[model samples]
Every structure is written in structure tokens, then in C-alpha cells.
Target: MRKARLGVFKFTSCDGCQLSLLNLEEELLAVVDLFDVAYFREATDKPLRGTFDLALVEGSVSTERQKEEILNIRDRARYLIAMGACATSGGLQALRNWASLSAYKARVYPSPENVHALSTSTPVSDHVYVDYELWGCPVTRNALSEVLVSFILEKKPALRGYSVCMECKRHGIPCLLVSQGAPCLGPVTRAGCEALCPALGKPCYGCFGPKDDANVESLLSRFRLMGLRSEECRALLDKMNTYAYRKVQGENRS
Candidate 1:
């Protein structure tokens, strides 16, 4: 059988997600046996050509050029997978979506006029159709494995949809919010990190982004009741997955 053609592309990101794939290390041999490994400069200096069976794209679209590239990739690939928080939810840079572009440029750049950038960082889905999204700051290798195996088997990958709270319970970790009064996004954030932070006795940073069933209103109210100011509540939701949470409007905007 002809092996599936695989490609990995990067944009403006820390490249941690790609690193996870490379970190597969001992297990990578298994994946390699199945795929053609068509294009991936991060793992190898391989040249890219022709259509791909699957393209795992990282980073959000922040430039007109990348927007065009993503569309073209979507057109060519049999399937397009947006990897990590960056590609799925515009990443941390999406915080600028609501801010003053001129002021932001003036402050961040010495020659603001020379800056070739957009006012917002948006997810890949904003520009093209996505077959799947592997969420994380750097996507977990386990999730990547599941997706890869599913694709190879011609079956849908079983991506979880519940909140991280379920993982906390499964791991028998006490609730930080209920027991310690800590502001934990685990109640509203998606599962995948396995409650890693809360397991280590810290609050969740929402690296996997908010769950679709996330109750942003109740979470913010809980924050306010716990002595967080309006601005503080707003700031809590303004991190990496800012664009993914749609239920946070009208808070601290008076």
C-alpha cells in the first residue's frame, strides 16, 4: 500500500508542538513505518512538493501571506489538522484583537511603518476548513498518536469534549477552587493536559482552551466572588485562547 503523505508546517510559534512530534523518539519509528513523511523541515531539511495526504499546521494566521498559504494548503491536502492552541484559537497573540493596532505597533516596534502585520491573530479555521484540531500550548504526543492512528485506520480520532474537572476527579486531585479558593479554569477548560497543573497543586492556565460547554459567566462570577476585580476577571480570560472563548463578552467593559 502507498504510505500516506505527511507534512508539518509552522508559522509564528515556539515550535513546541512540532517538537512533541520529534520527541516521539522511540515511538516515531512506528509512525514513520506508516507514513511517507513527505515534508517536515523542523524534523528534517526535506524539500516540499506536490499534494499532501495530511498537513499538521501550527500557529495562527497573523499575516496576509500566511492566510493565503493556509488556504492553498487546505485546498491541496486530503485533510488539514490545526495543531496546538495557536492554530486552533489564534494563540496568545489574539489578545491584540480588541486592542488599538496603531498604539500596539508604536509600542512594540521602533519602525512601526516597517511592520508587516495584521491587527489580529486568528485560527486556521477562520481562513479555511479544518478536519481536526489538536489543542495544547504544545500538543501532547499522546493526542497526536491517537489522531495519527485514527487517520491510518480510516476512523475518527476520539477527541474528548468534557472539561478538565473530569480528569481531576479521575486522578483524585482535590478541587483547587472548592478546597483552596483558587481560580481554576479546569472547570471551564478542555481536558487533555490531564489536570497536570492542578495535579502539581496550581491553577490551570487554560492551555487547552475553553471547553465548548464552558460556563464563562459562572466562572467569572466565581472569580468576582473570590475577590477578583472586574479587570482581573477579564484578564483571566485574555490569555492564549482568547479568541476561542465566546462567552466572555461585556465583562469589565463599563
Candidate 2:
């Protein structure tokens, strides 16, 4: 059987998600055997040519050029998978969405006029249809493996929709929020990291983004009960997955 043609593309991102794929190391050999790897600038010098069976896109649409490229990529690929927080929910750079882009540019750049940046950083889904989303600051190898296997099997990936707290329970890790009064987002954050930070006795920073059934208000109430001020609660939610948190809140409100 002809291997599925794979294309990996990058935009405004830290390339951490792509690194996770490469970090697969021993597992990468199996991925190579399954996919043709038609185009991947990070892994190979091969220039993009024909249509792809699958396109794994990382990063957000933070510029006009990227917006156009994503649209074209949508047309070229039979299936498009947005990888990481950047591609799925606009990454840390999306923090600029709530601020003055011009002011930020003037402060950061010597030649502000030379910088061609959009006022907002947004996910790929905002620009075009995304068949699937793999959420993380840098998606975990297990999630990548699930996606690859699902693609080969021509089935939907079995990503967990539960919160990270479940993973904590499964791993038999103590709840930092409950036991030590630490401000943890595991209650609202998605599973997949396997309670990594909590297992190490650290608070979850919500790198996996919000779970589908997240109760932001309830979590905020719990935080307040734990002696966190209103500002502290807001700050916690307004981190790496800010856009996603806001979106979920908006959906709940509407």
C-alpha cells in the first residue's frame, strides 16, 4: 500500500511542537514507515509541491501572509491537523490581542514601520477549517502518536476530553490545590500531560489548555474559597491558554 503523503508546516511558533515529533526518537522510525513525509522544512529541505494526504500545521495566523498560506494549505491537504497551543488557540503571542499592537511594535522594534504584524494573533481554525486539533504548549509525544496511528487507521484520534485532575487521580498524585493550597489549573485544564507538573509537586500551568467540560466560574469560586483574590484568579486564567479560556467562557455565556 502507498504510504500516506505527510506535510508539516510551521508559522509563528517556538517550534516546540515539531520538536516533540522529532523527540519521538525511537518512535520516529515507525512514523517514517507510515508516512511519505512529502514536505517538512524542519526535517528536510524538500520544497512543497503537490497536494498532501495529511498536513500537520503548527503555529498561529499572526500575519496576512500566514493567513493566506493557511487557506491555501486547507485547499491542498485532504486532512489538516492543527498542532500545539499556537495552532489550536493562538499561543502566548495572542496576549497581544488585548493590547495595542502599534504601541507594542514601537517599544519592541527599532524600525516599527518595517514590521508587518497583525493586530491579533489567532489560531488556524479562525482562518480556515481545522479537521482536528492537538492541544498543548508543545503537544506531548503520546498525543502525536495517537494522531499518527489514527491517521493510518483512517479513524478519529481518541483524545481524552477530561480534565488533568483525572490524570492526577490515576497517577496517585496529591492535589496541590487541595493539600498545599497551591493555585493549580488541573481542575479546568485538559488531560494528556499525565499530571506531569502535579506529579513533580508543582502547580499545573495549563499548558494543555481548557478541557471541553471546564467550569471556569466554579473553578474561580473554589480558588476564592482557597483565599485567592479576584485578581489572582483572573491572572491564573489569563495565561498561555487565555484565548481558549475566554472562548469557553463566551460559549458558556451565549
TM-score of each: 0.95, 0.97
Error of 1 at 30 (Å): 1.5
Please provide, for model 2 over 79-118, each residue's C-alpha lDDT reduced to its tens digit, 9 standing for 90 to 100: 9999999999998888898899999999999999999989
Query: Which 10 successive residues of model 1 have the least lDDT summed?
Result: 245-254
TM-score of 1: 0.95
Candidate 2 C-alpha error for residue 77, in Å = 0.5
Residue-wise C-alpha lDDT for candidate 1, range 71-188, written one tens digit per residue: 8788779999999999999999898898887899999899999977899899998889999999988899889999999999899998877899999999999999999999888988
Cα error, residue 176 of model 2, in Å, equals 1.2
The best candidate in terms of lDDT: 2
- The CA-based lDDT of model 2 is what? 0.91
Worst ten in a row by lDDT for model 2: 233-242
lDDT, residue 18, candidate 2: 93
- Evaluated with TM-score, which candidate comes out highest? 2
